[model samples]
Target: MTVETIGWNTAQRRGFGELIARSWSDAGLRLRYEREPAEVLAEYDIHLAAGTTAPALPPSPGELVVETFNAAEAVPPPPCMLSICFCLQPDVKR
Candidate 1:
């Protein structure tokens, strides 16, 4: 099994959600997001922090899980994390 993770800071979750909501109905935007996520995210005013990089979306959809952390107190919690796990077939040698 191969696992991939995408991380979004606390501040960017809302904008990222907006992008995802829009992409649900906009095919072009969806394709564009897949190809150029940073550019698309900029449209939502979601910019990555210095030295941070956004991971490319999975080649094809498989098992995906979105997790958000929330503390009991009013203090902010950790960033939003998305995990994707997929099984890859082993290479066969002839």
Candidate 2:
């Protein structure tokens, strides 16, 4: 199984979330928060039985990556019904 992760800057979080929530649905993805880059790790239903997989943790130094254990496969999370994430920021109200 393979998972997807997305990292957004602190200032870009609201804008990005709003845009996604506005167009995305309830995806089965999980959000793993990390400091510094402020990242969100999204796992997919995809798997890698015979091939090599990537890791999705601690990420990497200078750069981030998908941490995959030997038996750990990534699965795509449920897709959101909405086109984006409803950002409830004080400055961003629909």
- Predicted structure with the largest lDDT when compared to the true one: 1
TM-score of each candidate? 0.45, 0.21
Per-residue alpha-carbon lDDT of model 2 for 1-94, expressed as tens digits? 2223333344444444443342233232223222211223221122233333333332223322222223234255434453332334435333
Candidate number of the best TM-score: 1
lDDT (CA) for every model shown?
0.53, 0.32
Lowest-lDDT window of 10 residues in candidate 1? 85-94
**What is the TM-score (0 to 1) of candidate 1?**
0.45
Q: What is the C-alpha RMSD of each candidate to the true structure, in Å?
A: 14.8, 18.2
Model 1 misplaced regions, further than 4 Å: 1-10, 55-94
User: How does candidate 2 score on lDDT?
Assistant: 0.32
Runs of candidate 2 exceeding 4 Å displacement: 1-7, 25-85, 88-94
